[model samples]
Target: MKLLLLTALTMAAFAANSVLNRAAVGEAGMDALAFGVIRLASGAAALAVIVAWQRRGFAMGGVGRFVAVAGLLAYIFGFSVAYRGLDAGLGALLLFGVVQVTMFGGAVMAREAVPLARWVGAAVALAGLVWLLWPRGAVKMPVGGAVAMCIAGLGWGVYSLQGRLESDATQATAMNFMLAAPVAAVVWFLWGAEGAVTGVGLALAVVSGVITSGLGYALWYAILPTLGAARAGVAQLSVPVIAMAGGMVFLGEPVTGRFVGAAVLVIAGVLISMLGAQVWAGRVGFTKSSSGS
Candidate 1:
């Protein structure tokens, strides 16, 4: 129950990130590169404070530190830039779908014994994403935006995989954000920070960085031990649905039948992926115990 609560909170934070980014970049006229840089810097500061409060000194070197930092930068910059041309809903669908696929592939490469049910669940979730995001009419999507979102998803997947190897969630996340902030700053300078930025946009970015991203990532790392790669990937399918619902509530977007249907399918897929393996394993153990007895 505790784990479930923590996971739910982490997913909510992830969903809130989409809303905040949309508000900052789309509504408040903030430059995507600037927003990304601010978010990384603010997140680093927030995590640093938390680490200081906890008396944990900075320790950044590890087995996958380089990969983690690179992945973090890719996700931050790609996500910010991709949203410039991509619809929020469509962008989220693409990002989550790619993240799931990347993580599943990584799990296979790492020789994790993923069961068949999880694979089917992933397919069902992808189908649901397609159903939700497929254009109904003559909507044209920018190829560059799609590619950027895909890269963002891939980066997030790799970051999540690296998190699974960390012993200290808060410390690791703090170090990653700290290291990535300077890189993001450099990218923002090179990427042309020439867009309008209001106070509201900066506030939104700060909230997203300090709360949704920093603390959210810490919670995610804490929960990763309980959820393996496939389950973790499937579980994140809820983020898009939550983000859509948040849009309806906060952004005044209308909820349609397609969204309702897709949300059901996605939720069902996550449940099946997470629980089916456990149930099957439990029954197998029971049968063996009975036979031995």
Candidate 2:
């Protein structure tokens, strides 16, 4: 019972990131670059503190560390910038969709044995994304936001892939964030100077960094093993839905028929994919999967 509750809490925290990002970047007039930079720095600090409390030193040298840092930067900046033009729900969906595809593709490239259901599910999800991303479609999604979210998803996917090699998840993440912080600030200076950060914006960014992202991730890693791969993968399908509900309640975003249809298609597809491998393995839950939510 406690495990289930913790899992739910972790999922909510993950979804809250989208809501917080949208609120900060879209409504608070916070410059996206500033938000991204601050988030990275703050998250680094918070995670550093957590790691210290555990009496673990940071791992400063590894090729995987470098990749993790790079991927983290890309995801942070892309997510911040994308939210300036995207509703929380839409942004989450795009990010989620692309991330699944990227991870699935990576698995295929690595010669992982993918279940048939996963392949079909991936196809269905891709088709749904195509429907949503159609240039001249009924939904008329913003091209720039969609593209940025895709980049964010790809970055996150790569980060997750690299994370599998880590012996200590918290230490790896703390190190990655620490390494990425200064670089993120530089990037903000170069191209993220368009928007300004208000007090509310700063608060939102800090909470998102220190709470939703930093601590939330720690909590997730703590509970993830208990949930197992298949349950963990299936549980993430709820994030976009939670984000959508959060958008409606907190961000005043509307729910149109097109969005409803798209959501169903994408989420259903991912859920099927998650369960497919479990069923194929015959009683053993899926042990091969990526964790992005």
Alpha-carbon lDDT, every model: 0.84, 0.72
The local lDDT score (0 to 100) that residue 96 gets in candidate 1 is 89
Model 1, span 1-293: residue lDDT tens: 46557777899999998788877877888887788788889999999999999998889666588899989988987887788888766787788888988888878887777888788888887778778877677766799999999999999999999988888999999999999999888767786767777899999989999999999998898888667787789889888888889989999989999999998998788777766666676777753311110
lDDT of 1 at 183: 83
- Most accurate candidate by lDDT: 1
User: Model 1 segments beyond 4 Å from truth?
Assistant: 139-141, 283-293
lDDT of 2 by residue, 1-293 (tens): 47667867887998898788778867987877787788778998999998999999877857888887888887887887787777655676688766766666666665555666766766675566555544442454688988988899888877766655566768877888889999988777787466788999899999988988887766665664444333444455566666766988888888767767866786777666655555566555656543222
- Name the best candidate (by TM-score): 1
Q: Which ten residues in a row have the lowest lDDT in candidate 2?
A: 225-234
lDDT of 1: 0.84
Candidate 2 backbone clash number? 0
Query: Candidate 1 — worst ten consecutive residues by lDDT sum?
Result: 284-293
What is the alpha-carbon RMSD of candidate 2 to the true structure? 4.8
Clashes per candidate, residues 3 or more apart or on different chains: 0, 0
Question: What global local distance difference test value does model 2 have?
Answer: 0.72
